[model samples]
Target: MKNTYITHALFMAMAASAFAVPSLAQETNAVADQADSGGLEEIVVSARRRNETVQDTPVAVTAISPSQLEASAALTIGDLQGAAPNVLITSAGTGAAAANISIRGIAFADIEKSFDPAVGVNIDGVYIGTSTGQMLDFFDIGSIEILRGPQGTLFGRNTIAGVVNIKRSRPTGEFGGKFEASYGSYDQMGLRGVLNVPVIKDVLAAKFFAFHNESDGYYKTVGTGQRRGGSNNENFGASFLFTPGDRFESLLTFDKQVQDFDPILGPLSRTGDAFAGALPAEFVDGNNTDNVYRVVAPSQQMVGTYSSPGVTNEMNLDLDVVKLTSVTAYRESDDQLRQDYSTTGLYFADRDQQYKQFSQELRASGKLFDGFDYVAGVYYFNSRYHIDQFTSVFFGAPTHQDTTGWSKSYAGFVDFNWEVMDKVRISGGGRYTYDKKKLQTAFTDPSNAGASFTGDKNSECWKKFTPKLGVDYRPNEDLMVYGSWSRGYRSGGFNGRGLTPFASALPYDPETVDAYEIGLKSEFFDRRLTLNLAAFYSDYQDIQQTTTVSVPGVALPQTIVSNAANAKIKGLEADFSAKPMDRLTVRGSVGYTDSKFKGFIVNQPVATGPTTSISRSFDFSAVDMIYAPKITASINAEYKLPLGPGDLKLNAGYRYLSRYDQQISADPALYPTALASAPTDIITVAQNDPRLRSDAQNLLDASVSYVFSLDNGLNYRLTGYVRNLLDDRGTNTSFVASNFPVYWGFATAREPRVFGVQLGVDF
Candidate 1:
C-alpha cells in the first residue's frame, strides 16, 4: 500500500523531530522577550539548497523581490501571478515563447515537442529543459523563487508541480549602471539596461543587461484587419565575475532572446448553445465579430518568429570544510509558427520549432558535523527537439508535419540539516533519477496521402528514487512549525504530434508524485504581522495525459500520448503581510485546491465513411482537474506619500480565479465526428465539446511610483501602471478542435486593459 503510506510518513516525521527537541528550547526563551516590535524585513530563500530566513524556511516558498518585481509590472512569468498562491503563469499562445508554468496544480499545457513540464523552470542555477524558450523577460532580477510542493529532494528534474527559481544580478565589484523606459497602451514600447564593471578590482568583475520591447496586437483580425497578440521582443545579457581567491568563485554567462510577433490564434467563437448549427460555416456567428478579443477569418499569418540563446559556467569553491560547486550550461531555441486556422484568410499553417540544451552540475555544500547541514549533488542533462509542419486548407488537402526529439538525464542528490536540539530542525533529501528518451518522425502519409513515412522510431527509459522528509519547530522567537514528505518525477516521451503507428510508436510512463506538507510560519504583532501557512497532500501516479483520438479514416486528430490517469491532489495555502502604518503595506494570498480523477480510460474514434471501423470507450473517471483551480485569491495595497521629490508609492492589486477546466472530456460522448455516412451521422456536438469551462475571475491591478533622490549618488524612478484593471475577458485558453477537421469551440482572451509609463535610473 504505497510502502505502507511511506513508512507511516517517515515515522511521524521522526517522532516529531525527537519529541520536538525538548520543548523547543523552553519555548524559544519565552518568545524572545515578546518580539521587540518590528515588521517585515528578513526574506532570504533558497528553498533549502542553502540560504535561509524565509521565516526560517519550511518551504512552500514565494519570494519575489526586486522591488516586488518593479511594483508588479512583472513583464513576464505571466506577470508573476497574483503574488503566487497556487501559482499559474501562462501564455500558451503569445510571447515569452509560449509559457505555461503551473505549480501546486501541476500542469503541462501542450505546445508539444515531446511534452514534459510539471513545473521546473530554473535559470541562473541552470535547468530549463524544453517548453521551447520557457518564457523570459525580467532582466537583472535578483530573486523570484516560487517553490510550492514536491520539490523532489533538492530540485531534481520535473518537480511534479513546483520550482521556479530565477535569480539574476551578479558581478558587482564597484562601478554601476541602470536605465529604463516605457510607454504603454497598445502602442507600447520599453527599454531597460544595466551594467557593472570593475575588472581586476575585486579580482575581476563585469556584468551587463539589456532589453527592448514593442507592442500592438491585443487581438484584431477579421479578414485582414491584422494584429493578433503582439509584442516584439529583444534581450541581451553578459556576466563575468572571477573572484580568483577568497573562497574561490567564478561565473561566466551569456544570453540572448528574440521574438517576432503575432500569434495567439483562438477566435472562431460559438460555444455552448448546443451545436449552434453544429459549426463549420467558417465557424458561423457572422463570420467572426462577437469580439472576445476579436479575430475572425485570419489566414497564412507571419510576423516575428522567435529565437533564444543561452550559455553559462558557474563555479564556487570554499572547500575549507566543504562547499564546491560547478555548473555548465547551454541552451538554444528557434521557432516559426505561422498559423491561421481559417479565421478568414482561409486555412494556413507553416510551423517549425527547435530546441537544444546541455547541462551539468556538481556540488558539495558546507558544515556536516556539529549542528549538521549539508548538500551534495550531481546532475547532467541533454536535450534536443525538432518539428516542422505545413498546412493550407481553404479548399482542402495540403498537409505535412515532422518531428524529432531527444532527452537524457542522470542525477544523484543529497541534502541534510540537523540542529537536533536548540529549537529543533531535522531534514533529509534524496534523488536518483536516470532517464533517456528518443522519438523521430517525418510524415506525409495519412494512409497514403502522398506516400512518405520514414522509419518513425521511438525509445524510452526511466528510473526514479525521489524522496525527502522534514521537520521544523521553533516554538518561539516569532514561531515556526513544519512537516514534509516529498517525492516527484515526470519523464516519459514519444508522441510529438502523432498521426499513426499507434501515435508515434508508443511510449509513456514516468509520472509519479507523493507529497504531503504542513506548515506554519508566524510573526505576530511585534513583527507587524506576517503570517504564512501551508497544507498539501498529493498522490499521483502514471498520469501523463494528452489525448485527441479519432482514426477511423482520419484526416488529423491523433496527438496521442498516454499513461491513463490516477490522481488526488489537495491544497490550502495562505500568506499575509501587514505594516499598518510605516507607509502602509498589506499583502495577502489564499489558495485552496482539491483536484480529483482517480482513474481514467480512453480509446476513441466512432464512425466515418468507406473503409472505416469503430471503437469507442471513454471513462474519464468523472473528470475535473486541468489547471486545478478550486479557488485562488490575492490582495495587495501599498501606500507611501511623503512626496515632493521622492517617495510616493501607491499600488493596488486584487485577483481571484475559481472556476477551471480545460480538457478531459468536456463531453459530447467523448467527441465523435464524421458527420455523414452512416452510424447515425456520427457527429457529437462541436467546438470544444464536453462544454468548455472556465469562468470566474476578478482581476484588477494598479500602480504608481516616484522615487527621486540626487546628490551625485543618483536615484530616480517613476511608474504608472494598470493591467486588466477590470477589463476581464476571462477564458484564457480553451478549445474544441482546430487546425483541420473542425468542431467549433475556440477561445483565448485575457489581457484587455493595460496602461503604462515607467522610467528609472540608479547609480
Candidate 2:
C-alpha cells in the first residue's frame, strides 16, 4: 500500500510539474543525480548580489526550498532553523519586541537595549537596521539562504557571524492563483493566497501574495480582562517583473506585514502542567476562578483573589519594504514595533523601539566569458528615527523616551565567480565599508545620581576593507567540498538608555573577527541523500559583550549594552537527509559550537554610595561572558501510506538543544546587580553552569495529513498535528544584574504544548 502511494505521488508530482523532471530544482543545483551520473544545473542565488548556482559558487551557503518549507508548515524564522543548521531563533518573553536570532551559536547571549546582533538580516538586497530582539514577522517568502560565515565581502557591517537573506516570490508571465484556508484547534485559522497576472505579453507581469494567520496562545494569561495570549498576522506583497528579450530586465516589489500576539504571563512549575505547560491552580472555573493574580478580600477569606497578571505584553509591528531593481536599485525599508512589555500586568512599564531605514544599491552583473560571472556595486544605508523609550519603570517607575541615535553606512564592492576548471570553482570578492554614528538626545531622568542624559551624546566612526577568498571542489556531480576565509566587523556606539552620566558616557571599541572554514556538500544515493558538513574557527577582537549597569536612583533594575573584549569560536555543523526508499524521507541535523571570551573584562557602572570610596563604585573590570554549549540536533521524517480516499502522510520531527545558560557572567562579581550594594567580587556565576542551564528538552512534533485530488485543478488536505507531544517544559530563564551587590533578575518559561487540527482546500 505504501508503495502504491509512492508510485502515485511520483506520477502526480511529475504530472503536476508538466510531466517534466522539474530539472528546475535540479538545474539550479547543477549536480547530476548519483544514480543518473548525468550533469545537472547548479542552484542559483543572489548571495553576492548576482545569480549563480550554490554548487558553482565559491562560498558557504545553505538554501531551503519552498516545498521543504511547505512540508513542515514553516511560518517563522524558528521553523527555518530546522532546515538551516546552527541558526538559533528564540524569544525574550514573547511578542514582537525581542526575537533573538543567532547564527552559528554566536547568539546565545542576552540582548541589551538597542545593541546590534552578531548575525544580520537582509530581505531583497536591503538590510534591516535594528535588533529589538522580538521582531520576527514575515510571510509568503519564497526562500531563505544562510551564508554560514562572515558575509563582509559582499554584505557589510555586523555580518561577523553571517547573514540571513529572505527572498520573496515574484511575478510570472502566467495567470495562476492559489488560495488556502485552514482551521485548527483552539480556533486556529490560517489563510494564504498567491496570484499572478500577465500585464503585457513579454514585457511585464504582476503578482500578488497575501497571508493571514491566527491561533490561541498555548498558555492562558490568568486574571486578564481579555484572552491572555494568542497570535494574529496579516501580510501582503505585490511584485512586477519586466523583461525585453533579456537585454533589459527589471523587478519591482513592495511588501507589508503586521502582527499581534499576546504572550503568556508566567511559566509553569518545575514538573510542567498536567495538560502541557500551564500554571496550575489558575483559571479553573469561569468568572471568579482563582488564577495567579486572583486576590481575595478579608471578609471573603475563603477564596480571596485579584485578577492582575504578573506580566503581559501587547504590541503592533508593521514592516514596509519597497525595492526597484534595474541596473541599480532604490530600496526603502521601515520597520516599526510599538510594544507595551511589562512584568506588572498593567500597561505602565512598556519598552519601545522604532526603526526607520533607507538604502540605495547600484550594480551591474552578468556573464562575461562563458565561465566567468562578475558583479560590481555601490551601496548606501541610512537609518534614522531609531527611537528607544521606557515606561514609568525607568523613573522609579517614571516613564521616559529618547531619540538621539541613528546609523549610516557607505560601501562598494566587486565580486566574481569563475569556473577555472570543470572541477574547481573560485570566487574572489572585496568590499570597502565606512560607517558613522552620531547620538544627540537627552533622557528626562537618569538613575539616582543623574539628571539629564545628554553629555554621552558623542559621535564615532570606522572604516574597514574586507576581502574574501573561496574555492569549491566538485570531484564529481554528486560531491563538493568548499573552503573560504573572510573578515567581519561591527561599529561602536554609546548606550543612551543609561541613567548615570558615567553609565551612558562609556566608550566602546569596534568589534572584529577573522574566520576560516572548510565544508563538504554532497548528495548520495541518486538524489536520495543530501549532506552539508562544515567546521570553522574564528579569532575575534574587541568583541561586543552585553553587560548590565546599575542605576541606584533610576527606576528600572538595570541597563544592558555592548562592551569591548576578546573572544574565540570553534564549531562543526552537519545536515543530512536520506530517502532510502521511494516512499520514506528522513532528514536530520546536528551542530557543535564552542564560543568563549578570551579577555573579556566587564565594566562596572554603578556609582559607589556617597559614603563609599571611588574604587568601590567605578574601579572594577572583571572577566565575564563564557562558553555556549551550542544547539545540538534535530530530525524529521515523513512517511506515506496508501489510504482509501488518497494518501495519508505521517510526519514526525524532534529537535534538541544542549544545556547551557542563555546568558553568562551571572556571579556576584560579574553579574552583580542582584546583590545590591555588594562588592563586585561577590558575583560568581559563569556561562556554562547548572544554575543557568536552559537545556531545552527535545520537542517532538508529529502530524498526519490526508490529501485528495479532484477532477478539476482543485485539491483538499486535512492535517492534525501536535507540537511538543511529550508536553515538555520549554524554559526561558536568564540572569541579568549590574554589579555583584545590586540587582539580578530572571524571566519566565516558554509556551506549552498545543494540539491542533488543520483543514485546507486549494483550487
Candidate 3:
C-alpha cells in the first residue's frame, strides 16, 4: 500500500509538470485571446450572489466556461466527473435522469424522495429539490461554478457538502442562431439548435433551444441479446429577458425534458457462498464470468422513463441605496422504472412516481457602510411526491407498496463582508431553517391471502441555525491568504422504502457538519502561472445511514434509515494553470482526502439456528466511508495552431482516481452470520470478492477542432473527440445484498471507449 501511494504521488507530479495549469476559462471572454496576451485572464464568478473575481472571493471555487465544456466534451452533468477537485459525479443506476454526486466525501445515492442530497444543484438560481431529475443536459450554458465546502448560510438546507451553480445564457437582443449535429460510437446520434431574437427592441429579448440525443446502448443480455444502458433524450427551453428600463428587469424561463432509456445492472452472483445450494441454478450459471457488460436475465429488457417540466421567474429592482431580487419557480417530474434485480428474470420490480415542487425567494443587497456590504434573504420551499412500487422476489407472488410524502421548509439568512483594514477583510453569515415533513405508506402481500396494512401518517419537524465566519489577508496584489469556519445541516425524514408499517413510520434524525478551512491563492512568474491551494477538516455528526434490518414476520429484510454514525473528513486540494508558451496552455489539479468513521455502531441480525435469530450491536468504526477516494488528480493541455484560413485546436485530458469503498458494509465480516457451522471457505472467498470494491482507475480523453469564418459573416467548426481512450472498464459502484438468502451483488461499470465527430454552424 505504501509503495502504491508513492507511485501515485510520482505520477501526479510528472503529470503536473507535463500539463501545468487550470483549463477553466474566464466567464465573459474567449480563452484564445487571453493566451495571445501571454497572461491568464481573471475569472469572474457569482459564488457569493455577486459578481467578483475568483481571486478576490476568498472561497474555494472552480468556474467552468462554455468553451471549456465544449473542449472537454461535457454533454451532460455526469461528464464533469474529474473537472473539479474532490468531486465525483456518476449515473445513479436507477435511471438515466438520476445522478449520484459526491463532494469532499459527502454523498447520497438513494432514489427515495424522502432522502435529501448532501450536495445541492442549482440552475439559474432555482434549487432542485430531488436527485431524480438532476442529471441535466448541457445547452446554451454561460457558466458552471463548483463551490467546494459547506454553503449553509447562503444556500440554506441540505448543502452540507457543496453546490453546483449553473447559469444559462441570457437573451442577447440579437438575431442569431446556432445548429449542431454529432454522431458517435454505439450508434449514438445528436442534434441541437439555439435561436435568439429581439421581441421588442431595447425592451425584451427571447432565446430558445432544442436538443435531441439517442444511443443504441453498450451492454447486452445473455441469450436474449437485449440492450441495456441505452437512452433517447430530448430537451427544449425558452427564456425571455424583459428589461423595460434601467432600474428594473425581469427574466422568465421555461424548460421541459424527457428521457426514455434502459436501466444498467450487472449481476455478480456468489456461487461459492454458504447458501449457494439454495440459489437458483440459472443465476449461478448465467453470471459465472466477470464481464460487467454482459448479464443473464429472463426479462427482455428493463425500461426507464422520466419527464420534467419547470418554470422560473426572476425579477430585480435597483434602488439608489439597495437592490431587491425575487425568484419564483415551480417544477414537476414523472418517473417510471422496471428492473430485474434477481438476474433470473423471474424476480423483478416496477415503480411509478410523481413529484412536484414550488419555491420562492426574496433578497436585498447593497452597501451598508463605508467598507461593509450585506445580503439578506427569505426563502420558502414546498414539495410533494407519490410512489407506487411492486416487487416479486424469488419467483414469489408480487407485493405492492404505496408511499406519499410532502415537505415544507422556511429559512431566513443574512451575509455581510467588511474590509476593516486596507489589506484585511472579514466575512460572516448565518441562516435559520425550519423544515417539516410528512409520510404515509401502505403495503399488500398477495401470498398472504391478500393481506393489507397501512401505516399511520407521520409528521416530523426540525430546526437548525447554521453559521459561517471567514477572514482573508492580502499582502500583495498577486497573493491572498484566507481562513474560514462554517456549519451545515440536512433535514430528517421517515423511511419511504420500508416494507413494514413500523419501519415506515420510524423517523431519522438530521445530520450536520462543522467545517474548518484555510487556503492561499497566488500568481507568480509575471502572471503567467497561477496556483491555488486549500486544506480543510470537517466534523460530521448524526450521519443518516441507510441499511437493511430484519423485521419479524417478513421474509425479506426491510430497508431503514437511521442516524447511525459520526465521521471525520479532511482533505487537501491544489490547482494550477500556466501559459507555457503563446500557443500552448496547461492545467492540472490534485486532491487528497482522508475520511474515517469516528463512531459506527449498528444492530445486525445473527442467525443462531435454522428458525431463530437475534439482534446484536456491532462496531464498524474502522470501515471506510463510501465514495471517499483517497486521491484524485487530472491534467489537461490545449494547443492552438494557425491553419490556412482558421485556427486548429488540439486538446487532451487525463484523470486518475484511487480505489475507494462504494458500499457502507464493504467488509465481509459485517455480513450477518448464517450459522455456527457454516463453511469457513465461503466467508474466506467472500472476503476477497472483487465486486465489493471500486478499483483504481485512469481515464484519458482527447479532441481536435478547426474553426473558420466565411466572408458572409457565417462561422463554422468541425470537431472530433474521443472519451475513455484507454477503455478502462472499472467498476463505478457496487451494490451488495448479503442479507438475502445468498451473498449476491450487482455493479455498474464506467463508460467504455467512445469516439465521435461533430459539425456546427453559426448564422
Candidate 4:
C-alpha cells in the first residue's frame, strides 16, 4: 500500500515536470528583470546538498538575513517563534538549557532521545542531537534558514519535524571586522567580534569570531549558598578559506565554545505566591547554598540566623555543592505522588545534564555543465559530558535521587546533489552513521534512592541509508512551483538503569520518516512584493517514545523506552513580504498543522502492531503528545530614514505565539505505574500520564534599533529591546513522581520584562 502511494506521487510529479518547460524559460526571463530591479537577488541554498536559488529548490523554506536576526534579537530558536510561524521553539524552564523545539507540530517529549525529535537542530551542518543541546545560543551567524516539514532525504540523522540550518560567517577577501558590546540589568555583560583577514591575497583568506558573556543569577539560592539562573559563557572560532583561484577549494574551520552554567534553582511550591512563613524566615531565599536539612518547631526556630545576635540552629548544613551533593532517604508508608497535593508544583531535583561537544564537516560544491550543478561532503564528530543532577526538598534537605552516568556518541554521514536537467532538477544523497552510548549510577548502594543502581547499560548500533530527492518547475515567469520527497532518521540508544525489568532498553529500533511536500516561491508587483507557500505530509514508523514512572515498593522511578507508536503529520506554511516604499518593508508568516497517532499500542512485548481498523490519523491511542495545535504568527515593519549624519534606519516589530502544550504526556491506564505507598493525600500518576499536562500561554515580544555611519568608511549601530513586553506569565509544569510526591513545584514564571541596549562598530 505504501509503495503504491509513492508511485502515484512520483507519477504526478513527473507529469508536472513534463509540462514546465515553457514556464522555466519564462522564469529565467523574469529573474533577469528582478536582477535589474535589485529585488530578486540570487539566494544560494544547500537544502539538497548543493547550492541553488531559493525558487529552484523543491523544499518549503524561510530564510532570515543577519540584519533581520539582529533587529529582532532572536538569540535562540525559542525566540524564533514569533519571528517565523512554522518554527516554534519554546522553553518550560529558565535559561538556554531547557527549551523544546517543535516544527510542524512534531516535538520531542522525551529530553533524553529515547524518543527522537521530529525536527533537527544543526549549526554549520553539525547535528545537535538532543533536545536540551538545541537550547544553545547563536553567535556570529550570517543567516538562518528554517525548512518546514519532514527532511529525511538530504540531511542525515534528524528529519522528522524539519530542519534549522544555521550558516556562520566565512572568511572574506577584504580585511574588515565588526564589534558589539553591551551591559544591562542583572549585572549583565556581553561582547562579540567578527573579523575577516586577507591571508594570501586572493588565494587564501581567514575569518575569526569571538563572544563572551557573564551575568548574575536571577533567582536567589536561599540557604543553599549557590547562585542559580546566572549565565557564564565563552565562545570563539576561526575559518581559513583556500580558494587559490580554482574549481577545487577547501575551507578549514574549527570552534571551541562552552557555557559554564549555574543550575536552575529548585521547586517553587506555587508560581509567584511569595514565601513568608511556609518558608522559614532564616531560609534566606537566593544566597544560601547549605545542603544540610534542618526542621524547626515554631518555638525553636530563631530570627535572622545570619544577622541575629544569638541564634543556635539545630543543623548547620555545611554545604560545598559546587563539588559534592548530599543525599537523604525516607521510607514512607504510602504512595508518593498525589494530584491534590501540588495543585501544580515544580520538583527542582534531578539537575544533571551538562553538555560539551566538538564537531567537523567538510563540503565542496561547483557548477558542472550547461544545466548541471553538484556537491559532496564528509562529516565527523565527538562529544563528552560530565553532569551532576539531583532532586532535593526545601530547608536544604536532599531527597531520594540518583547521580547517573556520563554520556557520549560518535557519527559520520556522506551527502551529494545533482542538477540533472536545466528546467527540471533531481537530487540524491545518503549517510552512514554509527552511535554508541551508556548510562550508569554514580552513587553507592543507597537503600531508598532511585537511579542509585550500578553498571552501565551500554548500547551501540549503525544507521545506514538516509537519502533525499526533489524537483522544481517554473510554472511561469512569476511563480516557481516545486515538490520534494525525502528520508530522515534518529539513532536509537539505551534506557536509564532506573527502569524495571520488562521495561528496560533491550534492543530498540531506529525510527524513520518519509516526507512529501509541494510549494510555490514567487516575487510580484514590480519587485515590491515577495511570497512563498508550501504544504507537506509526512509518515513516521517505529517512532521512539519513553515513560518515566515509579515502582510501588522501590524508592527510585522507572524509565521505559520503546518503539511503541506511529504518527502522521500534515501542515502548511506561508511567508509574505511587501516593500511599498524604497526604504520601507513589511514581513510576516503563518503555519497550520494537523497531526496524530497512526498505529500505536503501549507496552507491546514485541515490535509488531496488532491488526486494527484504519481511520483518521488521530485514531490511534498509543501516542502521548504528538498532536499539537501550535499556531504561531508574526509581523515586522522597518522604515529606513535619512537623518543628520548618514543613512539612518529605524526598526520595530511584534511577535505572538498561540497556546500549545510543550509535551503530550502519557495517561495512567495505557502506561501505568506499579503499586504505591506514600505520605501525600493525592494519587500517584504514571510517568507518561498526560493528565499532568502543563498549561499553555500566549506570549508577546518587540524591539527597535538605529544605525549610523561615519565619514571614514566606519559604521556604528545601537539597539534597544524588551522581552515579554506584556509580562504575560507563562507557566511550566512537569510530572516527576518517585515512589511518592518527593519533589513538587511549577515551572518558573515566563521571563520577566528584560530591557537591553547594545552598541556596535565596524572597522
Measured by TM-score, the strongest candidate is 3
- Model 3 C-alpha lDDT per residue in residues 346-431, reported as the tens digit of each score: 45778899999999999999998888999999999999999998887666888899999999999999999999999999999999
lDDT scores in order: 0.71, 0.56, 0.79, 0.51
Q: How many clashing residue pairs, candidate 2?
A: 55
Q: Which ten residues in a row have the lowest lDDT in candidate 3?
A: 21-30
Model 1 root mean square deviation, Cα atoms:
23.8
Model 1 has a clash total of: 14
Residues 1-763, candidate 2, lDDT per residue (tens digit)?
Answer: 2322332343333234421322221111112112222222245787776666665455667766654555555556656543566666666553243456666656534333345567777765555555442243343566678887777766535477788887666666765554455565556776666666678988888876656677764444444443444666555556777776544456777555455555343421121111222213332221211122222111110110101001111111112121223222232233333332322322233444445556666655667777787666677777654455554431244556565566788988877788899888788778898888766555665343355555546777888888888888889887888888888777676665555555565656667778889988887666667777899988877766655544445555355455545667789998776777656777788888777666444445434552232223332223223324466688888777778866788888888776655555434333234325455543322332233445456777888889776555455677777776776663454443344332323334544566666665443
lDDT of model 3 at position 427: 96
What lDDT does candidate 3 reach at residue 451? 43
Using all chains and alpha carbons, the TM-scores for the candidates as numbered come to 0.33, 0.78, 0.92, 0.72
Candidate 4 C-alpha error for residue 143, in Å: 1.5
Instruction: List model 4 lDDT by residue over 590-677, tens digit each.
Output: 7777666755554311101122211111123534343255566777776666667744555666665555544334333422121222
Ranking by lDDT: 3, 1, 2, 4
Scored by lDDT, the top model is 3
Off by over 4 Å in 3: 1-33, 223-226, 272-290, 449-451, 550-552, 607-611, 669-690, 738-743
Pick by TM-score: 1 or 3, better one: 3
lDDT of 2 at 563: 54
Which candidate, 2 or 4, would have the higher TM-score against the true structure?
A: 2
| Candidate 3 residue 428 C-alpha distance from true site, Å | 1.0
